[model samples]
Target: MPEASFSRGAHHPPTATASTAAASTAAAARGPDGPGAGLLGSLAPLLAEWLPRQRWFAGKGRPVTGFALVSATEILPSPPGGTTPGLLHLLIRAQQPEPPGHRHGFGCGHRRGAAASDCYQILLGVRTTLPPSLAPALIGRPSGGPLDGRTVYEALADPRLASILLERLRVPGRLDPLRFVREPSSAIPSILPPRLMTAEQSNSSVVYGDTFILKLFRRVSPGTNPDLELPLALARTGCTRVPAPAAWFEAAPPPEGPGPRPEPFTLGVLQPYLAGSTDGWQLALDALAVRADFTDAAHALGHATAEVHLAMADALPVSVLRRPQIEHLAAAMSERLDSAAAAVPALQPYRGALHAAYEDVAALGRTGRTWAAQRIHGDLHLGQALLTAERQWSLIDFEGEPSRPLAERRRPQPPVRDIAGMLRSFDYAAAVGGHDTPQDWAGGMRAAYCAGYAEASGTDPRDEPELLRAHETDKAVYEVLYEARHRPDWLPVPMTAIRRLAAAVR
Candidate 1:
């Protein structure tokens, strides 16, 4: 794919005048029903072929059997004088066959009997002839149906159409099942040209003149998105460590009965963009390059984390894990360890020691050691944190681990799970540039971080040694599997931690 290019202040209006002019006119004449029907079927084959190439597609390695159109609507009507271009919105359920010989094990219960269909949000720019600038976003020309011989591409990649969508979001309205909502206090410009952010992985983000960013969720699910939900909750409690949610959009399926519960799928979120801020991951790497002490920054990050946790505990529901829940948690960890060991040969040698770490959790539970659980930054790490030019830390991306199911990510978990993730991230930074830093650089930073956490939350993570250790071991095991699969060269980083952790237990 071509890299997204944008001029700082250019406003590309959504207009097309080519051979598509006739097609656009034809589409406009047919009214709304013209494009909605048969559009999905026409693009089914093309979507199946195109989706896998996208970075955000979760079922990358698997074959897509077919697409089931859950919802389709025309969000933007044809231009006043145009005949060739229109905007079509879709929520498609993609069907993929389960991998052969896939089985569920302990800790893996959350994912057992997983759904075969995954829903995706697609915004298409439909035209009869492709624009020269949008060739890169092409989804292929449909040979039949309402869009026959029409060039269709992902609309968000087009700044003109993206701006149009942003305008729609700036005002609260409903187009059938899709609802565009704006926070009452939000101040959004009616016309700010959008620039697509290419650095995004699982979702597409568009920045409007460095003032606000709209994150369009690709793979969507029922229930509230924690990315918007948690930050909104934190903002309510006067938390400054998170960006306030300005506006958001969602698609709510029609109610089935008088008391029916319709699952609302968050389609996009708009937040004030932090223009001059840098992510913690890059800041750590920069500090490592100069051999600068990152303890201060790490300390601040810990304090921010604790603040968010405390605010979440105040704003959302909290639970105390009893013996049964603790047992289930331990079993889940053991299952993950077994799966990792089977996948990564290097983990087999340390499997017994890892099992002991999980067993320790079970033993602690047997002694009636209760633990507090609440909604947290489910996938916290260095990358999830942002450090402003003023040296303050802000948390971003509360979507949690994208691979996990929606219900699992929303379930309450010990806050230490997040701390463990950050701890592992520190080790990763040290390993990435091990030669430039002192042997205990990462360790020192980790200690300072925990110290800061204890100071802010008034509860030391180190006080719960068994819970912390088991969570850390569980995180390391996950890293081993992830590294082995995605980054073989980085496998040693987590492997080293695994060896030390296992030996410590021994």
Candidate 2:
């Protein structure tokens, strides 16, 4: 997962809704060695303020210094004295001052220089005058720059422009650096009214009627994103537990970059939309509202997860985490705990206990134990699962944690990492649902989920107590840090898990 990646918080639908570092149109005409640039100009100041404010912007802790154009394409350039809005697709690299005492390599695709920079995907809607309906999506009127005297807002917020995105997917071709590709067997219906999806935290999604959903990666890097890669792999296995991508788009990497020529960056994916499907998070909450049993759903989800995991193992590369790899894994987890604790003081007291859990893994490795590793859903939670009209479980959003590097997300890992995330999600549902005995509900669901996994895979996750506990601890620590930074109100949810896990070690 690049810092800019997709997160499936909810599928609720219309909302509202580039690259080049600094090369000019003249430079492009001359065929300069650089990718492309110079689209933002005076708009840089406005973007400095506006970029960090977006939910998908990952550089939250630091102030934006400036922006450089990586690439720019005028989907519909603004015409002189015209009322019709213009759409500009841009990839801009946002520069931010490095935090004091921050070590390098925290996340992938970050440019380290005078300032740390992260590239973002932006769609700008340019209009001569603002419409009342589009006001909420306004980025701000640039006082000067290329977009002078014009109102610019999020392009995806406008249904007409969003439909343009779908049309691009419908007919696959190259838009210079960007390329749209579709499955040979798939045909996307033209002119499906596009509606913006709300509640996504990391990426933007647009639904084309009820037929397809397109997720646009907000923060971008140069590589094939697992959200597109993994589902395609599952599709090859004939797995219906995950929605296969119908059409997708990507950007070719800049040719001038150092090191190996990087793979093209996955920009967006289009997949079959499961209309009327309830996400597992909402379903669990609804069940708790009525004091209904969710263990049945949990069990079914676990089985579905097993099926996908098995398929992924068969379809993608698998490896064994020998003593050295296992030791390195535990060390990495411990390092994350240390870094997270420093930023979140609430985690300080639990550090000792959590470290002990990681040590348990290291100890097991010292005894020459090994664990099997395979390509599994890097990030799995209740929100990532859906219950269809048929009441069957289908997993979505294989992008993994957005803060990780693309390479790490694509790497094979123990399947329990995903199981732990789902278990934590069940606890979150119980807490958010305000169940009287939240622990009791969550506990039963956890047990039932594991039982179902055992039934399908012939192995219970609980059978490896130390390994399971370590992974769960890792997930909880990550949750605590995420909640602390993004949603303070949700802090206590992971804190509860931290307390229990710490106490258990005691």
Candidate 3:
């Protein structure tokens, strides 16, 4: 798959997420200009305009997207930060749709849904030096509020101007300047306040090999970034599937009584670059290109996925939610289903069928033992896995759902959630992507993966049928909603799964 451009490239959803980075040698060989000032100038406005429209933009991109530079400092003396500022932070603001119904058509011709209204920081991750005009844009500094109302970072234009700007900051010796957020704990640490974007989210600048990714975390409820926490915990447990962590950095304010106390917040993680790795989606696509080989590979992927989940259960600590009475589940389902039914008129026709499945799953939960769940790969999707040409599947990105609170994301849920996620991925691969003729492989692969999960976790398949089925059904429902909203073209993938589930139950 072709890579999306710059920091605007990667996207993970609320309660879910998505990284890689190469070096300068390869960067120079890149097709486009990459993300630069002129790039920023043109791209910035585009981002300001487009970000709000994206579902991933969190609560309507920007609510206000603009820029204000606080300070820019250069680490290297001679070479200025790439074509952008060495250390640049810009505060941004744009309009967002007023919540749900409060919105009225007020923008453009028709109302622009909810538009971002206020502006904040737009931190720059300029490679080497800070740009000149950019400094004037910093907002919320000790000085307070966004400086100049300039919408874009102008510093990227002059290399020398960017240099002097980078020299201004006083980084703490104890802190990693590159680290930016605590959600994805592991990240590439830039100089203190690397490049600040006064936007409404916390982001991580991670360089995983030749692929440089900036993961955006919208909701922040302090502590270690889950991105780092989950992977490291898994690594500590000696889990081999995930992409290994190379380096870590977090930003913290300089300590008291000392010179400059370091900021303790983690912003990003720098990982070992996986240059030409393909995600599971592409991997499956490739495998299906050769019908026979697809089964074996799918089976292996299923095995790997199951192993990862099992290892995950054993590795991270978990918490169990009090089992809700069957009625409670019915109520929740009723609400969700009602909304879904309204959204997709066809669902209203199957309301009875769907409710029956939810009740069964709820009963299973009621009778089963819920545990203090361990940390799970919250957003377990095929896109999260990396496949090398050698065919080794590398599980990556432990950051849980990007939408939920960090603590909630870290909280343990049914281990089945992850398994269901993978299963859904398999169907998604075959149904959505052009990976046909692997129907048998997909079925057999599911069995193998499930079996492997039981074997590794030592949890008997017979012991958790209810939980397993419930999870699968839940995932199927979720997938249906997801596809309906995001990939309407592929809505049938999950809908078929749900209908299949309904039939099986019937």
Every model: Cα RMSD to truth = 8.1, 6.2, 12.3
Task: Write down the TM-score for model 3.
Answer: 0.64
Q: How do all the candidates rank in terms of TM-score, highest first?
A: 2, 1, 3
After superposition, candidate 3 runs with Cα above 4 Å error: 1-56, 60-86, 90-121, 125-221, 251-265, 320-322, 325-334, 365-372, 433-441, 460-463
lDDT of 2 by residue, 1-506 (tens): 01111110011110011122232432443244322322354456667767878889888878765555556777777874689888888876776676665666645333444566666889999898879999889987765445667888999999888988888888899887789999998988887988898889999999899889999999888788999999999998999999999999988755542457667879999999999899999999999999988889999999999999999999998999989999999999999999999999999999999999999999999998999999989999999999998889999999998888888898999999999999999999999999998999999999999999999999899999999999999999999988998799999999999999999888
Clashing pairs in 1: 24-83, 24-84, 25-83, 106-335, 107-332
Q: How do the residues 159-233 of candidate 1 rate in per-residue lDDT, one tens digit apiece? A: 878988888888889987789998898889887878999999999899999999999999987788889899999
Whole-structure CA lDDT of model 2: 0.83
| Better-scoring candidate (lDDT), 1 or 2 | 2
Give the Cα-based TM-score of candidate 2 against the true structure: 0.90
- Give candidate 1 misplaced runs (Cα > 4 Å): 1-35, 79-84, 100-115, 254-259, 436-439
Q: Model 2: runs farther than 4 Å from truth?
A: 1-38, 106-113, 142-146, 257-259
Worst window of 10 by summed lDDT in candidate 1:
1-10
Model 3 RMSD in Å is: 12.3
Quality of model 1 by C-alpha lDDT: 0.80
